[model samples]
Target: MSWTLTEEHLADLARGAALLGTGGGGDPHVGQLLVRQAIREHGPVLVLDPTEVADDALVIPTAQMGAPTVVFEKLPAGTEPVAALRALEYHLDRTADATMPIECGGINSMIPLLVGALTGLPVVDADGMGRAFPELQMETFSVYGVPGSPMAIAGEGGETVVIDTRADNARMEWLARGVTVRLGGVAHIAEYAMSGADVRRTAIPRTLSLALSVGRAIREARQANTDPVARLAEVLADTLYGHLRVLFRGKVVDVERRTEAGFARGRARVAAMGGATGQLELVFQNEHLVALVDGEVRCVVPDLVCVLDAEQAEPITTESLRYGQRVTVVGISTPELMRSPQALATFGPAAFGLPYAFRPVEELVPA
Candidate 1:
């Protein structure tokens, strides 16, 4: 089924995508504002289920590349994504059939939608990562063998570059990161152009709806004066994404954050606020990578480590984590696509340079 994405869906979509972002993926406010403006002017963007496209159709993933912090400070020029998309199509010499998200977290979730709104293209319901990862190579598209180049990147300053990094997406990221830094920290990108058949086979399906449901659940819970965190967990459990567990609930006591190498890198310490007499440490590189409780690993990557507000259930990005704020640490299993051997090799605990092996949230904290 296909439906139009109007101003109404933007807020909820942003909320849920932020949840799936773990602790990073840039902020959604800028994307939301730009998309809302586009929607208002262009009527509504159409979002199609993955099954709706033809087997041979060409799909391009639209996204932004840079430190989330940098983009936050230096807003997009609104034309950057459109510039990237057109540049990509010109290079391919084929008009794109649809737009897809590189990931379903924060700003990424809305970028394709915004592009679709502007281009009259249908945005695919699927995304490369069921959640967000800091690097381009970590996407399931790459794990499933989609080449990351012949990529197009458009800067806010009217500059654009078409990159052909051949088979290495890490190289694509390295090259793109350099461009983004030179662009003064943020630019729009379109890449991993693939066939509809391949997208259906590898992409995490229906995750946009999943993000919407999560955002809606939080809104409804708050409206009813109920437990928004529990509502969010229920929303996740409905998908194959696995259950949610509260790893810790407390007040943040320490934060070590810095923007280095065009990424937000840091660790946050949360001390138990109530009867629980312990503290938890979260390590991140743009996104929260692991959660350690009393010096033991409680949750790690390839799974979600969500840091949400204790009362409002709002997701806290790595850059926003500060001292003395009450927050709840939640964990959920990633989509199966993200847990495959190929994906694990790219993004599992070892990929994050952690010394321990990867463990599912369910195993670390059994139901």
Candidate 2:
């Protein structure tokens, strides 16, 4: 079945995307604004189930590639995402039947929505990555054999470039990263073009609706004055991602962050409540990659490490971390599809240069 997405859904959707983003994917606020304006102008977008797409229909995934911090100072002109899609359609000499998110976290979750609204195309609920990753090739679409180019990248000023990497998705990332950096550190991209059959075979299903549910759960919990993290855990418990665990509760004591090589790289330390005897450390590249408690690995990449305001349960992005804030670190297990040996090689601990081997969050931080 298909559903309509109006302005009413942006807040909850953006909130969920931020949490699912695990501190990366750029902030969803800007994307939210762009989506809202597009919807208000062009009317609500139709969000379709992957099953609703014809097996032969074309689905193009779109997103923004850059350091999350850069989007703060370099706001988009709002036309770039759709422009990238149009450019790709032109290059392929065929129109896309629908658009979908390459990543279902942060701003990337909303980019496809914006494109759909502006272009009058239906938006697919599935995505390449169930969560955000710092690099282009980290997507399951790439891991599962979809070529990432011929792809198009568009800038805020209406500039567009297309690349054909053939079968080297990693090379595609390398080239795109350099181009994104050159475009003042942020740009819109449309890539991983696939048939609906390929989308069903590889894309993570229903993540957009999942994000909306998560956001709504948090909002309702707050309205009822209940524990939002607990509510969040309950919400995810029944989803494809499975279990969630609260890893630590503390006050942030230090943060070191910087934009480099098209990513926001940083680490944050949080002391146990009241500055007590233990500490939790988070290392990240755009998104939370690892969590350590007293130097022992508690959660690792491929799984999700999320930080939320202890009081409001609002997700905190990597760029938003600061000292003196009260937070709860939560870890959610990744789907088994993303944990296979091949997928691990593409985005696991080793891929990020972390010494630890891959471990599921449920195993690493048992509830």
Q: Global lDDT of each model?
A: 0.89, 0.94
True-structure RMSD for candidate 2: 0.8
Using alpha carbons, what is the TM-score of model 1?
0.98
**Model 1: per-residue Cα lDDT over 1-367, one tens digit each:** 7677889988898999999999788888778999999988887988889998899999999999888888768988889988999999999999999999999998999899889989889999999888888888888989989999999999888788999989999999999988888888778999999999999888999888888889899989999999998888777777978689899999999998888777888889999866879989999988889999999988899899999998899988887887899999998998777887889999998887989788888999987
Winning candidate number (lDDT): 2
- Name the regions of candidate 1 deviating beyond 4 angstroms: none
Model 2 lDDT at residue 134: 95
Q: What is the number of backbone collisions in each predicted candidate, taken in the order shown?
A: 0, 0
Per-model TM-score on C-alpha atoms: 0.98, 0.99
Can you write out model 2's per-residue Cα lDDT over 80-142, one digit (the tens) per residue?
998999999999999999999999999999999999999999999999889999999998999
Q: What is the lDDT of residue 350 in candidate 2?
A: 96
Q: At residue 178, give the lDDT of candidate 1.
A: 88
